[model samples]
Target: MENLLYLFILLALGKISRRLSAFPENTPQILNLFVIYFSFPATVLLKTKNLNLGTDLAVLALTPWALMLMTVLGIRLIAWYRRWDRKTEGTVMLCTGLGNTSFLGFPAVAAFFGEDALSYAVIYDQLGTFLGLAIFGTLVVSVYGTSTRPSIKQIILNIIGFPPFLALTASLCLMKVTFPLPVIKLLEGVSATMIPLVMFSIGAQLRLRQPFSNVKPISLILFLKMMVFPLMVFFCLTMMKVHGPVLHISVFESAMPSMVMSGVLAQSGRLNAEVANAAIGYGLVLSFITLPFFDLLLKMFP
Candidate 1:
């Protein structure tokens, strides 16, 4: 509990620093690009290089991805029924579909479940979250924001150009290669910085004003993100008879707040900024309540 409070305080400090400092508003994006391109890839390459890849771990890791896809489809159907325009639908899809699985989920898992759980979190983040972001996320933005579908070459480039995705691919390819101890240590040190930096960037990007007037739509999205998403994960895990840390971590990943990048995407794509901001803001604030309840529920499950 004390650790959780400390983490929250650290996040608050980051937010305050963003407002008070003279740093350019673009600093977060620049840093995120650096982390994504450099540090994250280094980490992925270092960690996954020797990971004992297996069918069970792969299945466990994919649990959240399947749940996310189902949730997105359900949200899209709801949006269609409501006759939402493309921009609104895009914003909702990004918000509810893309949880803060990397920045927020990893740290929380490490804090509660210990460093041993970090590997599972990484698998969930890299193979599940990052892949979805590169493919499904790009599809959502490109399809809803414009009249023309993005070219296949564009999609390929987007995935290949993504820093973390590239790193994951390289690491998996070089799994048999061995590095010197010194180099391994260096990679670990650099990789350790990714989570805190990503979290701080999230805090810095948050803006209260953007989500101000979209309470109703925001509430609907929040319900799906916080409640429906976790339920879907739980149902899947139960049906598969998954147990222990895999089950717990999958539930936790599903319960993560909306992705902060959703707002950044909305701003970049010129979509509905109000809904994007609301989803990010409300999701972050509400996760404190939802996370603990999910944790308890996981304990209750067989």
Candidate 2:
């Protein structure tokens, strides 16, 4: 719980800074760049370099991918029913489908379930969530965004060019090689920066005074992210006869808020940045309570 508290404190600090103008306007963007290019990849390498590729590992890796696929379909239905504009539909789709698996998933899993379960969390983040964001998320942006649609070649290049994906590939190949203890320690030290940096970035981007027009979409995003998405993951995984810690972690991750980067993507994609940012801010605050409730519900799994 201390870790979670620290995360909240960092977020509050960031919020305070933004209100107070503690830094330049571009600070958040710089922090995000550091996270994307350095901290996140370091964390991925720290966690996955020693990973063992096995049957269960592959299945655990599937959780984020599977849940996201479900989310895409769900959002399409919701968008159609609501007759949402192209921008709103795309923004909602990104916010509801991509989860805060990295920023929130790691520390929360370690706190609630113990560090032993972190590998599963890493698998979900690196293999599933990160790839989804870097690749499929880009495709969604192109299709629904005001920007010209990217060709298949651009999509593949985006995935290939992602630092975290490169790190994943390197880690998998180097799985058999042992890093020097000093190198491991350095990587671990850098990995430690990810949570605080990410939390602060999220808070910096959060806008508390959302326009009234966005309330409905934000509400729908919360429901899908905090309740519907996780429940879908739980039901599907359970029916597939998956059990134990992997199942628990997967469900817990799905229940998390939208990825912090969704708004950035929204803006870059020329989608509805307001709605995407609002969804993330509201969804994250709600997750503080919803995650615990979901944890209790998971305990009921027989």
Candidate 3:
């Protein structure tokens, strides 16, 4: 409980800093790029080098991917039925499906499930969320976003250029190689900055001035993201008969709020800023209530 308060305090401080212009506008984006292209990959490589891959690992990793893909498609279908414009449709799809499983989800999981469960969470996050962002996420951003198709070249470059993906490749290929203690320490130090930097960047990007005309749509999307999505994951895990740490981590990942990258993509694709802001804002606000519910569910799960 105290730890959760600390997390909220840090988020609030980040927001306050942004409002006060403590950092330049572009600083967060640069930091985000560094994390995405460098720190995250190093963290993955350093952390998951000795991960004992197993059937449970595969199930935990794949569950979120399947759930997110289904949610995205379902939202798109609903948007189509309602005749929503491209911007609204795109915003709804991204916000409802993609989650901040790494940034916010990791700490919450660590608090509840401890350090050992973090490795499995990383696999679920990087292999599932990061890859989903590069491929399916990119496709959605491109399809409903701009007038032109995002080139295959661009997508390939993004997937290949992502530091985490490269790190995963390196870890798999060089599993036998041993790094010096000093080198490992340096990597660990840098990796530690990824989360706070990501959360602060998210705080900086939040726009609270968006109109409330679409309050109903925003609330519905938030409900799906913060509530329905996790429920779906829980049902799926039950059907699969997953238990213990893997089960706990699956629910934790499922319960994360919407991804900040959704808003970034929305801005890039020229989607409706109002809808995008609403989705992110409401998602963040509601996660405070929903995350604890998830924690309770995990405690009660057999």
The model with the greatest lDDT is: 2
lDDT of 1: 0.72
* Per-model TM values vs. the true structure: 0.76, 0.80, 0.75
Q: How would you encode candidate 2's per-residue C-alpha lDDT over 119-205 as one tens digit per residue?
A: 888888877787687666776776777555567777666667767668877887888898999998888888787767766766776
- Displacement of the residue 207 alpha carbon in candidate 3, Å: 2.5
- Candidate 1 displacement at residue 248 in angstroms: 3.6
lDDT of 3 by residue, 214-246 (tens): 665677678888888888888788787888888
RMSD of 1: 3.8
lDDT of 1 by residue, 149-206 (tens): 5687775766566566677677778778888899898888888776566556556665
When 1 and 2 are scored with TM-score, the better candidate is 2
Model 1 misplacement above 4 A: 1-7, 17-21, 82-88, 101-123, 130-148, 209-213, 240-246, 259-278
Ranking 1 against 2 by lDDT, winner:
2
Cα deviation of 276, candidate 3, in Å: 5.6
What TM-score number comes out for model 1? 0.76
- Candidate 1, run of 10 with poorest lDDT: 1-10
- Candidate 2 contains a number of clashing pairs equal to 0
